[model samples]
Target: MSLFQVQGLVKRFGGLLATDHVDLSVAHGEIHALIGPNGAGKTTLVHQISGLLAPDAGRVLLDGDDITALPMHRRVAKGLSRCFQVTRIFPAQTVRDNLLLAVQAHSGSSFRFLQPRSQAHGLYEAADRLAERVGLQGCMDGIAGALPHGAQRTLDVALALACAPKLLLLDEPMAGMGPEESQQMVQLIDSLRQDMAVLLIEHDMEAVFRLADRISVLVYGRVLTAGTPHEIRSNAEVQAVYLGTETLEATP
Candidate 1:
């Protein structure tokens, strides 16, 4: 079974149907990319998936359980974690401390019988692992906000990893990054399939082509197509609707 599934989701805003019967799936160990032009309802779909917005119809199933009415935090507990377009790291804190906090939140009963110091040590180990996972070990002592833009985004990804997610939701993780930073982020994302499935929402077609196992095209609040990278690249309809009109990258 798929690790995550969005079935016939529907949402509206008074006069507008922002999300119209959208269906999507992310399988275990798959990197599924979602791409579309502006106002295609990608953000709206993500908000519903992340529990930031409620859907008017359809169901969200994570690991065979329904989570449509669950709140954001509840969804996180169920192994659904998201990284937003904007970085969401604790600015004043050191990267180590930020990761420590995230680790502690998900530690649950594992540290219950241990003394405070032992628990601290356990949290520290988990934090260090997360830092290492994202290539942020060198920046662990650095203040999160003071780091370079790319590093800050990387830290935000680490924070989400703390949840030990089964499905990782990444929204525009490479936004506001330079070419070097974008490359680094791409590598970090590529490495994630070993641990969990990723549902990526991004406009960077170059990265999408390179990383996605499968790509889903969203147009006018509906899925226009879903296929492998080569198939998507070769699709005439996709090129006409999106790739043709888009440069797919920004100034480095």
Candidate 2:
């Protein structure tokens, strides 16, 4: 069974049908990419999946449990975690401090003055591992906000990883990144497939083609098609509506 499933999801904003019976799924350890033009309801679908907005209808299932009605935090606790389009990190704190906070939250250990020394050591160790995992080990002492845009995004991803999620939801992780940074993010995301499934919503078609095990195209709040990279590239309809004449090669 798929690790995550969105079954016939429907959402509305007054007179507007923001999400229209959208059905999507991510299998265990698969990289599933969602793509579309602006106003395609991709963000609206993501919002409902992440519990930022409850769906007007349909069910969201994570590892066989129904989670459509669960709040964001509850979903996170249930092994579903999200990294927003905007980097969500503690800018004023050092990288280590930021990771420590995330690790503390999910590790069930507090950083209290009276907390056990061994537990505190474990938290610090976990924080260091996270920084290394995201290639931020060298910047542990640096203020998060002072880091480059790509590094901040990497940190945001690491925060989500702290939850040890069964499924990871990444929203435009490569947005605003230069070629080198985008490549780096792609590699990072690729590596994550061994540990968890990813539901990626991105505008970067090149990255989508590279990283996605399967791609689902969304249009006007509904799924237009889902297929492998080659099939998506070959589909005349997808080419017309989204890719146009733009080459689907990694930016160099």
Candidate 3:
């Protein structure tokens, strides 16, 4: 069975059907890319999967168990996590503190105001390990808000990993980055697939093609196609909707 599965998922906002019976599956340890133009329901679908928004109809299964009714925190406890397109971090906190808090949250510790810092040594050590994995060790003491934009983005991803999730959803991880930063983000993501299953929503075609083991194309709230890079490159419908005819023809 697939590690993660969404079957006939539907979500509506009043009269607008934001997601139209979408079905998708991610196998164990695969990097699956979901690509589409703006307003294609990628983020909406992700929100449903992450439990920020519940689906109107259909079921979500993780490891053959139905999780459609689970709340957000419950879902996280089940080993699912996501990183948003916009960085979400405690801007006023130091990098170490931010990650330490994440570790504490994942470890189910109390959120006490007067808790001593020493009480979180194990959490900090785990946070330090994650920071090192994402190449953020050098900025451990700096205020999270003061770090460079690229580093902040990396921190966002590191925070998501604190839960040691089985399925990781990344929404446009390279969204506002320059070429160099994009490259770095790609490397970081590539390094992660050895241990986790990833569902990536991204606009950078080059990165998508490079990192994805399988690709799903969404258009107007429906899947247009799902295939390997070579098959998707030559698919007539995909070429017509997104990749221009000229570009399709140029592919050998």
Best by TM-score: 2
Per-model TM-score versus the true fold = 0.93, 0.96, 0.94
Worst 10 residues of 2 by lDDT: 243-252
lDDT of each: 0.91, 0.92, 0.89
Highest-lDDT candidate = 2
lDDT score at residue 1, model 2, on the 0-100 scale: 90
Q: Model 2, 117-233: lDDT tens per residue?
A: 574888889999998998999999999999999999999999999999999999999999998999999999999999999999998888988899999999999999999888888
Cα RMSD for predicted model 2: 1.7
Better of 2 and 3 by lDDT: 2
Error of 3 at 18 (Å): 1.8
lDDT of 3 at 251: 28
TM-score of 3: 0.94
Please give, for residues 64-136, the per-residue lDDT of candidate 1 as tens digits.
Answer: 9999999999999999999999899899999997988789888873534245766478688888988989999
